[model samples]
Structure formats: C-alpha cells, structure tokens
Target chain A: MDPGTVGKLIAFCNNGQMQVPAPEPATDPRRHAADTWVVIPLYNEISVIARVVGELAAYFDHIVCIDDGSADGSAASAEAAGARVLRHPINLGQGAALQTGFEYVVGRNEADYIVTFDADGQHRVEDALEMLDLAKSQDLAIVFGSRFLDDRTDPGWLKRVMLKTVVWVTNLTTGLRLTDAHNGLRVIRADAARAIHLEQDRMAHATEIVLKLGRTKLPWREYPVELLYTDYSRAKGQSVLNSVNILVDLLVR
Target chain B: MNVMWIQLLLVVGVITVGLFLARPTGGDSHLALRRLFMAAFVIVAILSILFPQWLSWLANLIGVGRGADLLLYALVLAFLVFVATTYRRNVATNRKLTLLARQITLAQAATEDSASIHRPHEGTSNDDAAH
Candidate 1:
C-alpha cells in the first residue's frame, strides 16, 4: 500500500462519520527498533503475558511491559519473554500505568512513536503494526485502533450497546466525533506522547486522552483494526458499571 | 423568662458528645473538620430549639432580625465550608496517589537494575516476582 494514499482521510461535520480507514497492506518487516516502542500495561495476566510479549518482540524490539502490581507472575513471565518490564508496588489503575510508560518513552526520547497495546489477547498484533505504519506514513501524531471499523469482532449485544453509549458520551465530552472512543489499541507520535498527560489513574484515563487530543495541535487518524475477543479476555475486561465510574470520574474529579 | 436546668444540661451534654465524636482522627484533618462541622450544625440546632429566646437574644446582638434566620445562615455557611474542604481534600488525595505511584515505579526500576547486576546471565529468571 502506498503509505500516503492509505486511509484517504477527509475531515468534516457531524453528519459525516469519519470512515475508519483500513490497515496498510503488508510491507517489509518494520525493523527500525530505534523508532517505535510498544507499551503493554499488564495486570494479573501471567498466562498471557509471555505469548503477548513474544509475539510483539518479533515485530518490534522495544516492548515495554508495565506490571500494575499483579499478584501473579506476569512481570517475570514478560521479562523472561524478552520484554523490558517495569513494575508498580501496588495497583494504581491502567491510566497511571500507561502514563508511566508514556513518561518513560517521552522523557528518555527512546522512540519516535509509542503504541499502547493491551496485555490481554483481545488486541491483535497486526492491527498495532498497521496503525504504526499509518501514523508513520501520514505523519500523523496519533492513530487510534477501532474494532467496529469493519465487521471484525462480535462483542455481543450488551457490549455493543455499552460501546455506543460510551462513544457518544466521550464524543460529547471530548468534542471529538470518534467512531470508537475507548479502544485500548492506540499509536501515538512521540511529540504528542510527550505533550499528552494521562492523569486519571483509572478507566477515565481513556476519556482523558481523548480530551487531551482534542485540546492539542496533533493531527490524528483512526484505522479499522480487528479486535480478537477471546473468552478469557471477555471475562477479565471492563464491565458496563465501570463505564459509569469513568463518567463520574470525568464529571466529579 | 424561665431557666430550665435540665434543658441546659441536655444541651451541654449533647454538645460535649458531639464535639468529642467530631474530634480529629489523627492525620486526616479534612475528616476531622467534616465531623466538627456536622457537630456544629447539630449542636446549634439543638440549642436554638431548646431556647428560642436565647437564640433571639444572640440574633439581636449580632444585628439579625430573627433567630430562625440566624440558624439558616449558619447552616448555609457550614455546608459551603464542608464542600470547599472536601474539594481541597480530594485534590490533595489525587496528588498523593500520583506521588505514591511514581515512587513505586522508581523502586521497581531499581530492583530490576540490581537483579540484572547480580545475575548477568539469568535473563530475568530471578523468581522474585508474583509470589
């Protein structure tokens, strides 16, 4: 795929939904390890971290695993699987963990771009790579990974309803009409990552990032990515009640 | 004007208990202030109910028209104070949590560095994680 022609982005009004662009066609394996960094915030995912890190290590050399006080051996397994693991003594929520990773990359100038991937197997490595390619190709500051971009994953009826409500609320609050607002798979340019700050240490951080993006000069793109929702990940993922908590966190604090 | 000694005792007794319960719980000054504010509200309401004439006397001294009006003003002021203090406390707690997270992250980095130093060849197999 010609990187420049990928996505065919056209910004418009509320009536027009930004057609989520498809991922770029396969290219040479992205070997420039000095440019891209992947931040995976791991909790109690001992069974999954090793496989996740191993796969990420194949495509990108800089894999940063942030262990959020997992009582399981997630950190050890990730480290053994060739990941630069950073740990927290206690659980500080996903927002804080991602911020810590962002600071690590932005503060040290480690990579040109940073990708936030899930510790669980719900997110696909292909989508992350594609987003990274799109961001680099378009010179965009951020590229958000979306599931509903195409008929990729079946997230059930209840989850589908909850996702729409969240997207609507997030769009209203953040002032950005994003197709999928709370998806974890995000690829951010280095400068935007440096300027961006995720302060809400809970799920509210997702909304915080979107709001920050709205307030920034960074240009962003959203690409259609497939989210492989496994039964294990489904059982461990955020609930609809957590969406309420995120809303309250945004409003009250 | 009649002075009921039993009424005075009840007022004093309730105020004392309320003040004691409202005492600061050591470190969290905001909680202490919240309890104290609630106690103040309860005590004032009790005093005014017991002696309307006494409340009116205080109101007149303070240039207020009615004792009920004075009580209403006090309640409003207490409620505002509670809200303002709660907001400040929440901000402080958020800042504290950020600091704690940063410290923990630093500690983790330090441990990882030391482990690499001690065992250069083990390649992250220290068994010091997730017990």
Candidate 2:
C-alpha cells in the first residue's frame, strides 16, 4: 500500500520511470470502446444489477452478465437493461460465473479486452473506463484496480487489515506484488485472458486468477480506483472468516 | 513412555499420508495406488479377524497397550484418509461440473445471439421486400 512500493513495482514492470500521458481528445476514447466487453458475474443482486448494467451500457456496447442461477429475475433485469445475459442452470459461485464469462468472451472473436466487473454495485463505471483506457494507451495486457493505492475507498479498519493480509498471501503465492488481492474490477486484454484457465470455482479464484495471470508473464499494472462501498455492497461483502476458506482451498489444491 | 513409539508412528503416518494425498495427481497409477491401499486394508482386516492374538502381539511390538487401541488408531487414520480422498474427489467433480455448466451457458448464449441476429435480418428482409 505504500507509495514507494507502488513506485518500485511500476518501475520494475515498466523497466523504467515511464510517465503515463493523458489520453488525447483527438483520438476519441469511444473509437475502440466497442471492442471492450464488460463481464459481470451476477449472483443474487436483483435490486442493483439493472442500474449497474444500464450505467455500463452507456460506454461499452458489449456488456455480458453471467447470471449464476439466481432465483430472482436478475438475468431478466440485466437483459432488459440492454446487456447480454448468460445464465447458468445452477448456482456455481462467483468464480465459476466469472470463468464462464471469460470463456464466453474469449470464444467470441469481437472483443479485444474483457473487463471483469462485480454485480454488487461497488465498482465505478468511470474507473472501469479509465482502466481500459490505461490498458489501451499503455499497451498493458492486465490492469488490476487497487483500492488501497489511494485513500478514496475506505473499507473500514478490520476489512482493511483482512484485505491487506489477503494481498500478502496472494503476492506470496503468485509472486506478483499487488496492493489489492480480490478487487473485481480488472481490464484484461484478450491474449492474457486467453492464458487464464481458472479452476478455483469459489472465492479462492481471486488468488488463483492472480497466479495464472502472473504466469502469463504479460505486462500488468495496478491502477488506483475508488470502490464505492455502499450499504448494499457492504452487506453483500465477504466476511473476514471467508479468508480461511480461501487459504484452505489454495493449500489443498 | 512405552506407548510413545505408537503415538509417534501414528502422528508421522497421518502427516505423511496427508501430505502425499494432498498432491494433485490423478491417473491410472493413482487409481492403482488407491486400490493397493484398499487391498492392504482388507488383508489387515482379515488377518486381525482370523488371528485375534496376532493383533495383540503386533500391537505390543508397536508399544500400544492393547490391540483394541491400535485398531482404534488405525480406524481413525483410515477415516481421515477417507475424508481427505472424498474431499479431493468432490473438488474434482465440482471442477467438471463447472466446466459443463460453463459450456452449456455459452452454447445457450450463442444460440440466442444467432436467433436474435436472424430475427433482425428477417425483419430487414421483409422491409426490403415491401420497399
């Protein structure tokens, strides 16, 4: 979380102190935006999915929601909101849904980048667009959204500690030092996304993803993004004890 | 102090087997090893049943106070192994299920996309004919 560490990571990944220039207005940000697919793994968030999808629909033409067998009409809502919806016959957890989205997007030849967004309304669309732009402009294969890079997102004291611990574990296992371990917002170019085959069908997939993406050895950078942890998102947020399950899953498999 | 050796052996055996089974490998050799272990277990069961005195003699050699105690320890160890193997199998099964479900979802999506595309084309073709 330290600025010095982030600077070192940026230097190491870029192999020099490179500055990211602001996106030029003449280039038109939406020129290639159609090639970016926003993949949302929907579980039971019926109340906010439509709004989330609607917001994303404004920028990205290809927004796919993988509905993980929600009993509620979340898939219908997402579909009605002008986004493509893929439904699983049964609930297979978030990781499975994300993998389904990844496979589906990669199978299609249109998308150049896949943005994995959450359904809980925690992530910001603006941040997603910025990350996509950064990936495109910098020619980076992966850009992970890290809330800890800045003080904009306050995840509380305990949650902060737990997240830091998870990040430590993730970095140790993946050999990629990231400030955030489980943030759902990521921009993955199609080539790097193709290299990912996530077998972790649960929360552990967060760590598994970092490990697999690291193995690809593609250029990656962590971008500072604000996570709007509303009351709804906080209610649906992962409990600190779930980290134990993630650890066991990583160790046993 | 006499029973220390049995405790040590049990602990070491449990840890070793747990570590060994934790590795992710599944094929004909792994299946064969599982069957060999089952065969050894069945032989031990038969020998203990046929020659109950031999169980006590072996237990004494291993520093266990009684044959029953040794049997209980072995049963516990076997139960743990069963649990471990079952958990691993369940994980493997879940992975397969995930892949299957993903394939179904993707296939269904593809069909829907094609159908929608065809529907729009049908509408446009009708418009062209009217023009």
Candidate 3:
C-alpha cells in the first residue's frame, strides 16, 4: 500500500521488470489538468465500481468507464464515481469495452497517456500512477504491469504454473521475454495505444496486443506487481484450463 | 446379373468422390477416424457391387430378395450421418473454444489495465493504504 513501493514497482517494470526495488516514498505527481486519463472497462461490477472510479479520479485528469452492456447499474455507479460512462449496446466483451476507452482517449486532447483499469475492485488506482510515471520516464510505447516479477506475491500453485506456461508459450511464439504475459495492467501512450488496433472483440485481444507489440517491435517494458485476488475475484474467475482454449483461439484466429 | 464389374466401378467412384470432396483439416485423431469411415464406406460399396448375386443369395436366406442392397444403403447412410454429425460437433466445439479464449484474453487485458490504473501517485489521497 506504500506509494513509494508502488513507484519502485513501476521502476522495476520499466527496467524489464528485473530489479524489484523496495517500496519507496510516493513521489509520483498528482492529477494534472493535462496528465493521463484513466479508462475503466466495467461489466456488472456494481458493488465496487464507484469506489474504484472515485479513487482513480482523484489522481487522473479524466476517468472514462466503458459499461460493456452490463445488465446491472454499473454505468450509473461509475457515473456516481465521476467517470464519463460509455455504454455498449450489448455485451460486446472486455476488448470492445477497452477499445472504446482507447478511442475516447485518442479523440480527446487532454490525454497524453491512457491507462486501462478494471471495473472489479481487484486493481488499485495507485498502480496506474506508477505505470504513468514509468512510461513517461522511459519514453516507452507501452508499459505492461507484470505479477510474476515479485516471486513473493505469487498466485497459488495452479495459477503460477498456468501463467508461467502462458508466458513461455507467448515468449516462444512472440519472441518477447515477458513474464506474466497475461497480466492486464498497462499504460499506453495515447497515440501508440490508439495505433494498436484490437481486432478481436473477446479475450484473445490480450494475446493479440502482445503479439502485435512484439511484431511491431514497439518499445515495451514489463513491471512486476501484486495481484489482488479477493474472495469475489476468486469466485468470478475462469479456470486455468481456459489457457489452452486461449491458445487454440490464438491458433485459429 | 453379370453387371458385377459395373457395380464395383460404381462403388469405387462414390467412395473416390466422398474422399475427394470432404477433405477436412484438423488434428490427427479426427483424421484417423475419418479415414476409417472412408475405408468402411469403400469396402461396403465394393462388397455390394462385386457380388450382387451373393447379396441376393444372402437376402433370400434372410427372406428378403434384393434386401441386402437396401440394408447396405441404410448402413452407409447411417455411417455417413454419424461422420457428418461428428464433424459438425467438432466444428461447433472449436468455435465455442474460440469465443471462450477471446473472453479470457480480454479479461486479462482488463486486469492488467486495472493494475496499472491503481498505482499510487504523490499528492493524491493515500488510496494505496493497506486495508
């Protein structure tokens, strides 16, 4: 929870996420009128949407939430949290929601960097600030937050094994020595992020982005961070077997 | 009655066409099964064509003249249906797998984005404070 530790985490992520510095003092900048924009792609996360948005809104200039056809009041909750809500007509999945957020950032002049956040309460807002700082400092095209760097805060045996396998396969296929290849936390330069078109409107879009980034040789960096797996997250989670399905999807797609 | 060669040719032609037409692409397991089905179809067709007299004799023994031809046709049709159904099921399963995979990928990206979104910055409320 230490902001300094968060900044060090960002630094670690920037430096190939190799050296994880101990938690430092939180010297990261506050929300500037011209700083980054936070984009939270939400579905049915009515319980925690407002808190997530309210927290991130304090540090970022704009908070845009793509309500991906949530049957619940996720959009209203996001709005209550002061997020500019964009609703999908139907459940177009998370990739489409994220693409909408990127589009919002690209169309606006106020955003220099774009941060993708989840609607679920799993991810903290402060991690976004660290990534923003790191992205700016390294002049990176894309900054991906990895959870595998700190061997201490690892997920259980099954997840660790599955993620390591995914990282291995992705590295083999894409030739990017990235650990935790499936971690979602990322900060992208507005132009660069927008330039990366996410064609797959489903989960495969994540793999697509990594592959495209490697193919394009965009200056990318991976940072290590902790994964907040709440009871709710554990309940709503997909099984590790889905990783094989993802691989097959990548093959067919 | 003596048109056994013609019948044999007919069976061979049908099998050749089936093999040429339904060229499915997938893993080896399915390829093996499809090959077996093709082989069975070819054998059945050849048996029915080459020995019409034998088929007629078998039918008479079973109290149904020329019934073996009907039986052969039924068997082939049933086998073909089964193979076709299996292929369709596999295709549907693969499609669903594709969709599920896509959803997982997006969820992961959203997760990464969420983490990056939460990192603490100076001057902001201590949101990163441990619960």
Candidate 4:
C-alpha cells in the first residue's frame, strides 16, 4: 500500500470516529475567536521557561504550569513568573504532568479553551491567541498546532522528514489527518478536553490522547503554528530514536 | 483387632470434624472444606499405608474390603479437582481486578478533564472563547 494511504488508515484507526477535512491553503492562528488558557507541563525547565511564561502571560488570560516533580526550581520560577502552578509529588511522565494541568483547570472551572504549550521555549506564545481565534470561528473541539502547514517554513530536512513520517503513522492509527502530528502546541475545547481521557504516563500519552480524540465524533481542526528551536532546546532533548520505546509501550499495552 | 477398631473410629472422627468446621463464607467455605477433606484423606492414606492388615480386617468386618480402597481413590481425585478449581478462580479474579483498575484510572482522568474545563476561576480574567 502507498505510505500516505497507510498513514491515513492508521490515523483513522487511532482517532476512532473524528473526521479531518481535505487539505486546504494555510492560514494564521489569529483568525479564531475563543477564550483560551495556556497550559505548560514542565520538568526541570528552569533554564528557559521564564521567557515562555512571560510570552504566554502577555497573550493569554490564564497560564497553568505542572511541575512534574522537578528537582530543580522550575516550578517556583514558573509560579514566580505568574502562572498558576501545580506540583506532582514525584516525577510522573509528561503525559501525567499534562493531565495534572488539565485536571487543575477543569477542577477550578476556569477555562473554556485549553492549549498545551511546551515549557522548553520552542513554542511561540504570540501565535497562541491566533490559534484561539481559529478555534472559536470554526467551532472546533480540538485544534492541533502544525509546523508543516502549507505556508510554514520547515525546521530542517531531518526534522521535517521525521515529523512527517510520525504524522503519517499517527494518521494510520488514529484516523486524524494532520500535517504536523506531533507538534506539542494544541488548543482544545474544555468539554472535548474533559471527554478525552489520557492514561499514558510519558510522551506516548500525547499519541494516546490524539487516538482517543479521533475515536470520538468530535470536531477538530489543524492550524499553522511556529516552532523556534534554540541551542537550549536542542541540547536538552532526546533523539527521534526514543520513539522506538513509545511504539513498544503502545504495543505491549 | 482392638487397634483396628481405634483406627476406624479415628477416621470417622476426622470426617466428622471436617464437616463440623465448614463455614458460610461462600467461596472460601468451599475452599476450606476441600482443604479439610484433603487433610482427612492424607490421614486415611497414612493409616492404610502403616497398617494395611488392620484396614483389610476392618474392611471385612464392614463387609466391603474393596469399597474402602475405592473411597480412598475418590478422595484423591476430589483433592486434585479442588486445587485446580481454586487456582483457576484466583487467576480469573486477578484479571478482573486489573481491568477494573484501568477503568477507574480512565474515569478519574475523564472527571478531572471535565472539571478543569468548566470550572470558573475567581481571579483569572475570562478570556473570550475564540470563535
């Protein structure tokens, strides 16, 4: 079978019943109109998180940070920078950390729209409001941020291919048709956020959520968002080889 | 002959004791009964092995020498069946508990997700829903 078709099948399987529209010309995030809360799940992001928090504070009304048992002062720094902070007793994986933030927001009845933002400073907070706008106009339940949109610049040859392959595979499993499937930045309605239960404890948890969301008949959209990788982000990250472990985990469970 | 009478009485006493100790705890009661039955069977086996002549004499006095051996075989088979059934039930219960735990965790995540999205914050500015 063609790789593209396989990817779509895989995505469809994972997404359950969610529908993705045919590809169209790229557009900016600012065109949507809903209220949004920026949620950043962090673990030892004390190095460059202040700027990420500041940028989000400038654009969104609510900023939530989950300190996933970081030994460093990442939680305090994020709290000091004005984000509502929640701390895990021990190091849960990023999925658990994101769940904690999602729970906190839902518990307080604070946000109608939720955006999962990375604390590593690779995401541009300025585009957050734009994504919010897009979500509102389209009445989308979930909006994934895409770095591989028609108008967006590709990060590099390696990253571009790697991300595209992941997107294709995810589409095959979940039935979601996204250009940048693994992009961490995503905006979702609070109801959809609550309905999609994620049990994955690590990075694979993101895939789990996307797959579950696709299974539901909820409405979703993919919008162009920017990724700015600095020296700091590259130094702290693991290679794409780690995806092997995620695949193994998914299969075993 | 006197010793043989005492042995017969001992076996009877053990059987009686086993039935008397059975409780009403449903599943465990049956398990306990099986264990007691096995223990009685072990005692009978040891007595027969130690004094085959006495059993033979007692079997004749009871007018059924072969019936005693058949009863012993029945007890052995019953013990084996009880052990197998217990093990199978335990394994089945463990699997059910695992599935239940997963459901509970997912339900918790679902509840948390809903609460965070709907609950309003007191101090936080209400950003308009992007549309």
Interface RMSD for all numbered candidates = 7.4, 1.0, 9.8, 12.8
Q: What are the per-candidate TM-scores when only chain A is compared?
A: 0.91, 0.90, 0.87, 0.83
Query: Which candidate has the top score in lDDT?
Result: 2
Q: What's the ranking of the predictions by DockQ, best on top?
A: 2, 1, 3, 4
Better of 2 and 3 by DockQ: 2
Which DockQ values do the candidates obtain, in the order shown? 0.23, 0.75, 0.04, 0.03
**Stretches of candidate 1 above 4 Å error?**
A1-26, B1-88, B107-131
Per-residue CA lDDT of candidate 4, range B70-103, in tens? 4564555566556545554654464344345434
Backbone clashes, candidate 1: 0
Quality class of the docking in candidate 4, CAPRI style: incorrect
Residue A235 of model 4: what lDDT? 74
State the C-alpha lDDT per candidate: 0.77, 0.86, 0.69, 0.68
TM-scores, in order shown?
0.74, 0.91, 0.63, 0.59
Backbone-clash count (model 3): 29
- Report the C-alpha displacement of residue A87, candidate 4, in angstroms: 0.4
Q: Candidates 2 and 4: which is better by TM-score?
A: 2
Candidate 3: true contacts recovered, fraction: 0.00
Clashing pairs in 2: none
- Considering the two chains of model 2, state its CAPRI-style docking category: medium
- Compared with the true structure, what per-residue lDDT tens digits does model 3 show for residues A71-137? 9898898888788777666676677678767765676556788877777766766666766666776
Indicate the DockQ of the complex predicted as candidate 1. Answer: 0.23
